[model samples]
Structures are given as structure tokens and as C-alpha cells.
Target: MSALIYCPFPDREAARAAANTLLDRKLIACANLLGEVESIYSWNGERGDSFEIGALFKTSAALLDDAIQCLAEMHPYDTPAIMGWRCVSVSEATAAWLGELDRGG
Candidate 1:
């Protein structure tokens, strides 16, 4: 199965940096930046809103955990919102590509 990781970065530069790191490490096959988005949430007993750059990472299920862990460690926010999950249904060709990507295929 394939996996998807959704994370919001502080800015475009940060998002690009993180995406490149993930690619260089072979943690993700590709990443898509969704531009700026307004995020509203409560943190540390306070509620606030801010604009963030959204990113989607494509990878295999085998690398999802490692990818998320690495991203969390490198993220700028004290508690960045990183969401990941295995895809319930993915085309055979795409799944194969994602798996092969992690193996440097």
C-alpha cells in the first residue's frame, strides 16, 4: 500500500527544504506544495490562526513512520501538524512505483 503525508510548513522556503530533504533521503517519491492556506487551531491553551504552506508527500507504507519522525524532528514549530495514513486504495502501478522509490529503484 502507498501512504500520504500532509504537513503544513511555516513558509515556501521551509516547505521546499523539507521536501528536498525527504527526497534526498528516499523517504518520499514526490511532494506537492498546495500553496498558502489559513490554519486555525488551539495550542498551549490558546487559539490562533495563521497562514501556512501545505505539502503532500507520497511514499510507501514502509517509510511512512520514518518520514513523519524525521519531519517532526526538523519542523520549525514546537508542535507541527503532521498527518499521515496508508491509502486504502491505490492503483497497482502507483503502489509499485512508490515502493520502488524507497529502494532506489
Candidate 2:
């Protein structure tokens, strides 16, 4: 039941802040932040390109909703790109760690 959530922020600081908030709330087990990434997408019928900080959060399915809520509350962007999917496969250790978080360990 493990999942990986992807959140893109306006900057590295914002990403870090959101990640820290999620961690503090025990909504996610781990977060890996990519300091710089170029994102090209169409918003409001216009093509836009910008640099962003991408964060990957590891957690269990049970915490996915909480993780998304944390991101929405802490993200600086008016509409943050918060998306995720259930992991099809994961190492036993990683799954165990996520389970521990689920158990409040």
C-alpha cells in the first residue's frame, strides 16, 4: 500500500518547507527534493516554462489524503501540482518503514 507523491513548488525553499511540514505531521515517511527542474506546461491556454523544485514523498496509502492536505496548506503556489499513485512495487525495508509510520512508530 505504499505510494509516492510528487509535488512541484515555485522554489527550493517552498518545496523544503512543505516537505518539512508533511514530515512534522507524520504524513510522510521520507521526502527527496530536487533543487532545480525545468517544467514546461500549458496553463490557462498558454504555454509556460519555469524552473521549479520537485519533491518526492514516500508514504503509505492510508496517509495519502493527509499528505495532499498538508501540501495544499503549506504550498506557496495558488495551485500546486500535487499528484501521486500507489506504488506497484517497493523494497521490503521501505514498505516496513512506511508501515511503521502508519502505526505511529
Candidate 3:
């Protein structure tokens, strides 16, 4: 199985750093960065709003746990938003690509 992970960073540099680290470690096959996203949420019984950089990572389910651990260690925030979900459907080519990535190809 393959998975897609989403994480929000305080800035683009941080997001890129995490993405590059994951990629270098072969924990993620690909990463897409979304810059300057306005995020609104509640924290500690308070409403908060800020701009952040969002990143989406693609990898095999077998690597998800390790990838998450790496992200947690590399993340700047005390509680970074690191989320992932199994991919229920994917093209044959994409699946094959992910498989190759898992094999370090």
C-alpha cells in the first residue's frame, strides 16, 4: 500500500528542509510544497490564525511510520500537524513508481 502525508510548517524554508531530509533518507518518494497558506484553528482554548507552508509527501505505507518519526524529530513546532492516509486507488504506473522508490531505485 501507498500513502500520502500532509504536514504544515511555519515557513517555506522549514517545509523544504523537512521535505529534503525525508527525500534524502528515502522515507518519501515525492513532496509537493504549498506556500503561503492561511490557516485558522484553535489551540489551548484560543482561536489562532497564521500563514504557513504546507507539504504533501507520497510514499509506501511500510515507510509511513519511519517517515512520521523523522518528521516529528525535524519539525519545529511542539505539535506539528503530520497526517497521512492510505491511498485506496492509484494508477498502475504510479504504484510501480512507488514500488521502485521503496526499493531505492
Give lDDT: candidate 2, residue 85.
Answer: 87
Instruction: Please give the ranking of all candidate structures by TM-score, highest first, separated by commas.
Output: 3, 1, 2
Assess candidate 2 and give its TM-score to the true structure.
0.93
User: For model 1, what is the error of residue 10's alpha carbon versus the real structure, in angstroms, after optimal superposition?
Assistant: 0.6
**Pairs clashing in candidate 3?**
none
Instruction: Go through the candidates in order and give the C-alpha RMSD of each one to the true structure.
Output: 1.1, 1.1, 1.0
> Tens-digit lDDT track for model 3 on 53-73?
989999988888899999999
Candidate 2 colliding pairs: none
Per-residue lDDT of candidate 1, residues 45-94 (tens digit): 99999999999999999899999999999999989899999997999889
Off by over 4 Å in 1: none
Q: Given candidate 1, what's the lDDT at residue 56?
A: 98
TM-score of each: 0.93, 0.93, 0.94
**Global lDDT for candidate 2?**
0.87
Segments in model 2 whose C-alpha atoms lie over 4 Å from true places: none
- After best superposition, candidate 1 residue 23: deviation in angstroms? 0.3
From the highest lDDT down, the ranking of the candidates is: 1, 3, 2
Kindly list the per-residue Cα lDDT of model 2 for residues 25-95, writing each as its tens digit.
Answer: 89998999967889999999999999988889999988888888878877888888899889978889888
